[model samples]
Target: MGSVTELKAADGFKLAAYRAAPAGASKGGLVVIQEIFGVNHHIRSVADRFAALGYTALAPALFDRAERGIDIGYDEASVQRGIKLRAAIKLEDTLLDVAAAVGALKGAGKIAVVGYCWGGSLAFLSATRLPGLACTVGYYGGMIAAHAQEKPKVPVLLHFGEHDHGIPMTDVEKVRAARPEVQIFTYNAGHGFSCDERASFDKASHEQALARTLDFFGKHLKP
Candidate 1:
C-alpha cells in the first residue's frame, strides 16, 4: 500500500519517505512522524493505516540526518542507539524534514500530523512552528514539557501515559497548566503504549488514542 520516495528539504538535504495513497479519492493528507527508531515497519504500517482511512500519508526518515536507513528493534540496545541518534539530530532539522514531507503531499487538501515517542514531540513542535497544517496529534512525547511555553499555531491534541517513567505526570501537569487550550488526555499505560511492537503496548490505550486522533483529523482536516 506504500512506496519509498525521496524528498529534498529546504536545506538541500535529501531524505527517504514512505508514501501511502488512499484507494479512492483522498479526503486529505497526513504526515506520520516516526519514533526514534526511524521509518521502520511500524511507522510504515502507521502510514498504511492512514491510507486505509482515505488519507494520503507520508512518513519521513527523520534520523537520516545523523545516520541513514535506521531500522532498529525494541530491545534495550536498540533503544539506546535510537536515543543517541535522536540526541544527535536537531529539532530544527527534523522540522525541515517534516516540511519536505508536507510539501510532497501537496494537493491532497488539508493536512494533519501525528507522531509517537520522539516523533510525538516533533508533532507538537510542528503545530507551533510548521505551516500548512490544520492540526496535530502527539502520543507520549517526553520533550513536550520542555516546550510547553510555546503556544501552538494550530489545534493540537496530546496523549500521555499516566505511568510513563520517561515522562512524569508532573511534566504532563505542567503542559496542561501552561497550555490550557490544548486538548490533552492521559491513559493508565506507560511510555510507548501505542506501539504494539513495544513491551509497554496497551491495546485499550492504543485504540482509544487512535479513535480520538482519527476524529480529530476528520474534524480539522476534512472539508
Candidate 2:
C-alpha cells in the first residue's frame, strides 16, 4: 500500500503512475494501464488489488501527455471529452510510456501488462512493440479493431464482451484470426464491463475476466 507518483518515459515524456507493493511480493511485475477516463480512483484501486495478489503493480497515466490528471465520469459530455483526449495522443508515443514503465520494473522478474478500454489497445501494442514483457492482457479495446493486423509478438490474453456494440463479434473474430497464438475470450456483457464506474459493468464477466487474466499472468509472468 503506497501513493501515486510520476515517471519519465523512454522518450522523455513525463507520465504519472501509481505503484503498489505487497509484503513478500516477489511475484512478477504488472503494469495496469488506465482507461480513457485517466488514472483515477478506479485505476489506482486496480493497482492496489494487484499488489494484494502478491505482485508489484504500476498504473501509468497515459493521459498525462494530452491532459494531466483528467478523471471524468461516464456522462455523454465526459465520454466525448475522453474520446477526444484518447485520440489526440499518438499510439507510438503511448507505447513509449509503457516501455518506460516496464523499464522501471526491470530485474523485478517477468513483467506483464493489463489494460482496459483505450488502455487495452495500448496494452496490445505494448506487448507487440515493447521489449521485456512476458505477457499482455487487454480488455474490451474498441480501438484495437483498427489495428488487428498488428499481431502481438508475445503471449497475449484478450477479453471482450459479446454484446459490446462498439466492438462487434466480427471485429473480435478478425483479431483472433490475425493472432491465433493469443488467447481470446468473449463474455455476455457490453463495453466497459470490467470497470465498475461504467453503466455497462457486469460483475460476472468482470470476475471471469479477472480470473483468466490472473491465470494468464501466472503462466507467462511467474517470477
The residue-by-residue lDDT of candidate 1 on 78-171, one tens digit each, is: 8999989998988888899999998998899898889998988989999999999999999999899999999999999999999999999999
TM-score of every prediction relative to native: 0.98, 0.96
- Candidate 2 lDDT score at position 105: 81
Q: Write the per-residue lDDT of candidate 2 for residues 91-129, one digit (tens) a residue.
A: 888888888889888766799889998888888888778
- Candidate 2 clashes: the total is 0
Q: Name the top TM-score candidate.
A: 1
Q: Which of the numbered candidates is closest to the native, going by highest lDDT?
A: 1
CA shift at 61, candidate 1, in angstroms?
Answer: 0.3
The TM-score measured for candidate 2 stands at 0.96
- Local error of candidate 1 at residue 180 (angstroms): 0.6
